[model samples]
Target: MMGLRGINRIVIAVRNLEAAKKLYADMLGATFHDAHWTGAPFGIHVSIAWDAGIELCAPMPGREHDSAVSQFLAHKGEGIVTVFFGVDDADVAVSRAISAGYACFHSLDYSQDEMDQHLGGRFCRYQESYVSSADRCGFGVALARIDRKPG
Candidate 1:
């Protein structure tokens, strides 16, 4: 059995990242970093509140139709988009999900060095796979494995 470690983060798709961040801050006391990261390939801007385990995502200007986040916001109207599960191994988790009749749609693997460069030496090695779930379970699921450097 490939057991998940825990809920890593809850991704919320929003029309405006700043507005969503403010809402979360006022309602839940969540504090996000000043630097907003862009997932250019996905055509979205991402902001995360690590302590709150919430991630806000919004479509980039002029690329509204190019990503899943935009499509989700358009269809469902700003809401929880994905629940990311922390796993020991993303590949195994994805395989288990597939065996369980779930469809895996996308995957990403990043080495520690790569992530370090991308995050200014703050992130760990990461692997993730996005699985389809909305049709049956109301929201999408994602399996992720993050190997953090030991203290």
Candidate 2:
């Protein structure tokens, strides 16, 4: 069985990233540790507060009219868009989740080297799988297999 760890991270889609960041900071006293242009294949900006397990995402101006973030914000307003869970094995976790009635939208695997660069030198291999929102209470759920021992 895949070892299912607890909540890994949460991604909130917002219309304005900075405003959302400030709101969260004011409410939770959380500081964002990193900011990046995410939505790689698409277009969006993301701010991450790793300590608080929060990721705030917003559409890039003029470039995101058709991006998923923009569509989500247009439909749902600012709200939780995705949640991630830490797992020992992404394949097994995804299989289990599918058996439990969840539908996987897609999955990806990242080697240690790729992840290191993506994470700014945090070296770890991992696999990630996304379960569609339609299958999980109208919010996307993702499983991540991080190369780390559970504490």
TM-score of each: 0.87, 0.83
Worst 10 residues of 2 by lDDT: 33-42
Candidate that would win on TM-score: 1
Model 2: how far residue 22 lies from native, Å = 2.6
lDDT tens string, model 1, 106-143?
89887676777665555677788899888888998999
What lDDT would candidate 2 get against the real structure?
Answer: 0.78
Candidate 2: residue 143 Cα off by (Å): 0.7
Clashing pairs in 1: none
In the range 69-130, model 2's lDDT, one tens digit per residue, is 88788877888889999988788898898898888887888766666666655436677898
**Model 2 error, position 134 (Å):** 3.2
Q: Model 2, stretches more than 4 Å misplaced?
A: 33-38, 148-151
